[model samples]
Every structure is written in structure tokens, then in C-alpha cells.
Target: MKKTITAALAVFGLVAFAQAEGDVARGEALSVTCSACHGTDGNSADAANPKLAGQNARYTFEQLLAFQTGDRVNAVMSGFAAPLSEQDMWDLAAFYEAQTGTVGEADAELVALGERIYRGGIVESGVAACIACHGPNGNGNAPAGFPRVSGQHAAYTAAQLYAFREGYRAAEPAADARMTDGESMMMRSVAYKMRDFEIEAVAAYIQGLH
Candidate 1:
């Protein structure tokens, strides 16, 4: 299983790594407008907004493009992303990737269940272990374009999971729908089988991941 996971990640990583590099300095200059929500360093104070600090450049770039293209539907994100060029997106991604992120504590009562689910899947439900893709430490797979889950806000993560689960139920999700997962629908598939409490638990655990 380990070998298989590694092999699959390697293949995905290759594609992700091929993305062109962006100018970090230029990205920083362009980040001023983004500071209102994401902070000057990308660490958002609001739980509703995700902390982009320490996120991989590739993932950030892809999300920006998705917002612009209407693949991910958020009115605010679309508005922010609409006018930006592809290179501008890359620059912003690069800038955010370089910043540090802060984390909050996890709820002790939920830790056990969350850790179990993150490391081991719900076999009966056919759910895949998050560790297979996000890594045990939650650093995520940069080559695979997986965003870091460590230190992320629980509220934000839970919201995304719920959104993905909703997408899973849609026979044909509308363009303005809130599905953020790409064509693979991996997130939706995993989230669809998870209970609400499970999502909440894991999200809480992720907030405290180092």
C-alpha cells in the first residue's frame, strides 16, 4: 500500500512541479490589496477566510484560476480574481507561499476521533485516509498540488468539506455552484461518505496540526 501510494503521488507530483515559477518580489507588491482579508502576510484573522500563508504556490495558483474561471464559486473570490492575469495570480501565490502561518488549538474531546480518521479511513464507508495525500504531519504534497492543511482554520476547512459534499450530491453542479474540487472530485468523494460530526472533528484537529 505504501509503495502504491508513493508511486501514485510521484506521478501527480511530476505534473504539479512542472508549473512555471512566479516572481515572489512582484507577488509581494501585488499583495497589498489582498492584505485586507488575507493579511499582509496571508495569515487571515477571520476564521471565515482561509490562511494562505505557507500554502504551496501551485495550489494557490490553481485556486485563483478556478475562481476566475467560475470553477470555484465564491462571489468575493471571483471578484478578486476576475481582473488578475495568470501571471498575477502566480505572483500572488508565490508571495503567500513564502509567509508564515499561525495555528489554533484543537478541541481535546475531538482529537482522538479526528486523528483516527485522518490517519486511517472509515473502511466500511470506503473513505480514503487523508494521510495518504496530506502526509502525517499535514505538510501536504506540493508536487501533487495538495494544499497544506496544517494550521488551517477549522471553520474554513469544515465549510470547504461541506461544500465538497454538496457537490458530490449534485448530478450536474451549476457553474455558480460551490464545488471547489477539480474534475477528479476526490474531495467530494471522500467528504460525501463522512458524517457532519466527523468533518467537524477532523477540521478541529487540522487547525492544530504542525
Candidate 2:
């Protein structure tokens, strides 16, 4: 079953991410506006925003496309994505992917619960462990378009989990609802089964995963 899933993912990645590689040098020049929210080096100081440093290029490009197409809606991000051409997006993705990511200290009190949720999902709830897609160190599967979660802000991670869960639970998702997990809706499915506390726990764990 694992092999079958891996094969499927490879095929999907081939079709979905078949694009020219980006120019990191050009990308740096294009990231002036992005530096406002995300730091100049792609690591956001604010916990509300995600740190883009060390993210998978393909994943970042796909997200830019999603925002541009209105498949994923964010008031701030959408506007930024609107004027960007495909090459521009790829360049920005490349630039961010080349930067280093930093980790924050997790709450000692939350580590046990958080680690449990991240390394082993709540069994009764049917939630899959994060390590399935994101590796043990939160590096993520680059070829499969999984973004690196290591060193990501807990607040941002939790917000995204909430977004995924809310989108999944809606009887009919809003046209502009955020849903970037791809056609399989894997993230939505997993997040839907996760309890609120579990989401918080896992997000906290992910923040300090590295």
C-alpha cells in the first residue's frame, strides 16, 4: 500500500510540477514587497505569517498559483500574487527555498502532547500522523510538493490547520475558500479528523521540529 501510494505520488508530481527550474538570483531582486510580511531572508519575524525559508520550491510555486487563481484565498497574499507572472512566482519560490529557516522554542508543557500528535496521531480519531508526509525532522517530501514544516511558526501553522478543517467541514466550501492540499484533499481529510487541541499541539510541535 505504501509503495502504491508512492508510485501514485510520483506520477502526480511529474504531471503537476513539470516546469522549468527557477532563477534564484532573479528571485531575490523580485522579493522587495514580499520582505514586508515575510522577512528579507524569507523568515517572518511575526508568528502570524509563515516562514517561507527552506520551503519546497514546487510547493511554494503551486501556492502562488493557487492564490493567483483564487483557488486559495488570502486577502493579503492574493493581491501580491495577482501581478506575478509564472516565471516570477517560480523565481520567488526558488529564492525562498534557498534561504535558511529558523526554529522557535516550544512550550515545555505542550511538548509531550504536541510530540505525541505529530509523531503519532490520535488513534481513535483516525487522524494520520504528520510524519507520513512531513518527515521525522519536518523536512517534508519535496518531490511530492509537501512544504517543509520545520521551524514554521506555531501560530501560522495552527491558523492553516483551522483553515483546512473549516474548508473541509463546510457543506459547500466558499468559492474562494483556502484549499491548497491538491485534488486528493489529504490535508483537509487529516485536519478534519483532528481535534482542536490536537491541531494546536501538533502545530506547536512542528514549530520546534528541527
Candidate 3:
């Protein structure tokens, strides 16, 4: 029994190591293509494009897969991701996640209001705290596959929230597979409750995250 357990543990360790190695190797190779838009270190200089540095690997991977499979639709991203394999997506995500990110400051009034909205949802408005999943500092959990919102551009964040609220942004098909019916319902409900002003406030708060 002891020997059998030992063998099983050894196999598990080897599998884990192999998977990690694969992700790293693939991520580095796939990153070459991403450097054009995302920058060499994942810090995009383009105002229209969000920086990917310090983003959660799972989030990055999921987005890539979504674009490739038509779960998420963006003309540019769809074309870019279409040719990538699963390993390629994983590798690129790892590469971006390994990079460092920069933070920007928010205006005093905006910050104060943003903080109120982010930490305490508007009860009358039926909004929920952004911290429920994004964590207090906006450093999203790797396991949960949430992207890091801290230090993200306010404009970019606001745009994304707006898209989600309008149902213009669809869940990556891969992500939908993992989500339960309840999860989807909650997301739809929460998104519907967010107005443009609320989106701006939360985004401003997120920009201040360091």
C-alpha cells in the first residue's frame, strides 16, 4: 500500500511539472506575435488596447480561446487568436502574466466617489461591490480566472463594463462551459444593474489600484 501510494504521488508530481513546463515554454513562443499590439512586455502604449501585463494567466488564456472560437468577438483579436492552439494560448497568457504593470492616479473627488461605489454597492440602485470577485486591491485570483483590474486605464475599464452591460460582450464559449447556470444568471443580473455613471466610478476606483 505504501509503495503504491508513493508511485501515485511520483506520477502526479511528474504530470504537474510537465504541465507547468509546457505552459511556460508555449507562452514564451506565442508571445512573439502578441508583442506587436501588447508591447514586448505586455504594457501596451496604445490607448485603445488594454495592457496585459500582470493580468491573471487564466483570464488571458480564456480570452484568447474565446476569440479563437468566436465566443468573444473582436475583429482584430479573432484574427490573431484563430491560428493559435490551446498550448499557444496558455503560453502567451503565462508570458503576459509574468510581466510587470504600471499604475495611474485618480482624481481626489473621483477616487473618493469611486471608492464608495467600489467598496459599497449602491443599495437603492441594486448594485454589488466590485470587490466581491476582484478582491479589495483589484488583484484578481489566478485560480478564479479573474483579470487584475488594478491600475487598468479608467477609460478602457469603463468601455468594457459598458460592453458587458449592453450585452455586446459575450462570454468566451470556454468560460461559459465552466460557469454554472446560477453564475450566468448572477452575471446577467449584475450587469443589468450597472449604469454608465456607475461604470465610470468603478473604473476610476480600479485605476487607482496599485
Best model per TM-score: 2
Q: Please provide, for model 3 over 99-174, each residue's C-alpha lDDT reduced to its tens digit, 9 standing for 90 to 100.
A: 7988877756678878988788778879787788788888886565556888888887776666566552445333
Off by over 4 Å in 3: 1-22, 168-187
Cα-based lDDT at residue 198, candidate 1: 93
Cα lDDT tens digits for candidate 2, 68-122 = 8777778798899999998888788888888899999887778789998888888
Question: After superposing candidate 2, which stretches have Cα over 4 Å from the reference?
Answer: 1-17, 171-177
Mind sharing the TM-score for model 3? 0.79
Look at candidate 3 and give me any clashing residue pairs.
26-91, 27-91, 27-92
- The positional error of residue 3 in candidate 2, measured at the CA in angstroms, is 30
Measured by C-alpha RMSD in angstroms, how accurate is candidate 2?
A: 5.6
lDDT of 1 at 30: 90
Q: What TM-score, to 2 decimals, does candidate 2 have? A: 0.89
User: What lDDT, from 0 to 1, does candidate 1 have?
Assistant: 0.80
Error of 2 at 42 (Å): 0.6
TM-score per prediction, in order, is 0.88, 0.89, 0.79
Write the number of the candidate with greater lDDT, choosing between 1 and 3: 1
